[model samples]
Target: MSATRLTVGWVPLTDVAVLIAAAERGFAAREGLDLVPVREASWANTRDKLVFGHFDAAHMLAPLAVATTLGLGHVALPLVAPFMFNLGGNAVTVSRPLAAALAAHGGLTGDLADAGAALGAVARERLAAGQGPLTFAAVFPFSTHAYQLRLLFLAAGLDPERDVRLVVVPPPFMVDALRRGLVDGFCVGSPWNSVAVDQGVGTILLLGNAIVPRAPEKVLAVPAERAQAPEIAALIRALAAAAAWCATPENRADLAALLAEPRHLDAPAEVVRRTLDGALVIDGAGTVRSDPDFLLLGANRPEPRQADWLADAMVAAGHLPQDAGNAARAVFRADLYDAALAARTRG
Candidate 1:
């Protein structure tokens, strides 16, 4: 019998590692799936393509998946996440000048609360001095990166809407945007933050886990109607196998090399490896910070609480109304994930 051919969309980021591994390392093939991993430049393009049927599934932001189902920012199309791609793979980075300003307020203490306090002081001082609000960029309006920024602002006691400027920039362009002074800081996933730090254009101020420990980041989103189809189940099992492979410490070097290919992240293998191992270089001065939970790929099961967290974040970010009850919970098909894995075991 011929394998089922499925087209999946993804942006070039470290978190998309599971999808890439499923395709490149024969996990999908083992499940009788011919996975076609299509690389996209931005999340909006990926979401649009998935919604328009250009993709069977996609590596999607957790919040974007909920927002799409709730029709918060776009046309109402129910999408469901049967498997989570990753958690806690994001970091906040600021330009060198901004870093210096923050240092002057109180050195970058590597603590999220301390950093927020220092940033709050600087933002207020800049406003009093007749300087415009410090600009920051996020990959998308409906992303953990955006929410992390809001959490930072709240910790600093600054209004995200009025005290600081938040804009959308593709992850790949974040470093350049900071370099050109288009934005003073950004919250993005690896290895872009590493790239910025390596180039001396930015400094890593805080990791995403600091704001929301082990926060759900990306998911494998598919049309809600097809959530239980056999092919989708097979895809989920394959991704689970692939994610397990990716989580093995011995396989990280090979995985990093595969992700460094020109068609994928197109970054240095060492940089990618460091990110996978959670030994990140935070600044140009060769400062290394390690955290095992920096990016958790092994535990890929979809959880309802993850959905609840995302919905709460959306509401807090003002992207969704407080009254938007439990609608987002339905978007994460944990039952489907469990069913797929159970079938795999039974078979």
Candidate 2:
């Protein structure tokens, strides 16, 4: 008889490339595992389902796993991130009006400290004129995008909580929100950022790299209890190997095509290519830059040290303790990652 299959849930996003690669490239099948990729409508839905044991594993926001593990925000569970999927694909964007206001405030350039002061100045001016506090959107409260937005505001000397409203809007509606004047700006992963710019509804403010510099963005999180099962363990090992395969340059193009399938992102191949190649158009100007290091897949580097930084952002945004470093690191599960690496290499 065939082994019992495992179901994994994922939010449709470009960074989810590794999961798609594993499913489509026969990596999961070779591990004697039946991997079912379920599409999720929202981050909240994905997290809740995982917490309810409806999902065996999931592609989760790195911070969400940390936050959930620590009971910092809402639900607490023993979540384990066995592998990091990708890094550095988030971008902060502003509506045309907000972008114009920021540009007029002295060109949105400089270190976080300088940007913080400039943003504060803009906020002060808006308040004096009796304008509404600016609003921004991110995928989730504990997501990298939220942290990146907070970092940008802090550098501009604006208190994220008091100075503006930070809200959660799903990725698919990001451009619409910007276009409708519902949010002044947002921080989201690609290709939403690229989508907004391409649709001419928003301006790219800063890349996530500018806020934290090659931060850990996403992780392959499995329930801690189930991860101990032998079949699940074997699947995890194969996933690690697939990630390693994706790290090679020659394989990226093929991976991109696979990710563009209707069952996957269903976005244009060019958009996927732009995401991988980092061909960006700045502030509606059709100039492109060659940024090959846009998203790191199956990276041959240390696991993204995201927990502390993510918790720090939570603290900065008033969601958790100011010094949540120790609590945050508890759930990262780097040991599992190392073991998976060993399994892949030994095979």
lDDT of 1 by residue, 63-108 (tens): 8998888777788789999999999999999999888989887747
Every model's TM-score: 0.98, 0.91
Q: Which numbered prediction scores highest in lDDT against the true structure? A: 1
Q: TM-score of model 1 relative to the true fold?
A: 0.98
Q: Write candidate 2's Cα lDDT for 180-213 as tens digits.
A: 9999889888878777888889887776776777
lDDT of each: 0.92, 0.76
Candidate 1 collision pairs: none
Best by TM-score: 1
Per-model clash counts, in order, read: 0, 7
Off by over 4 Å in 1: none
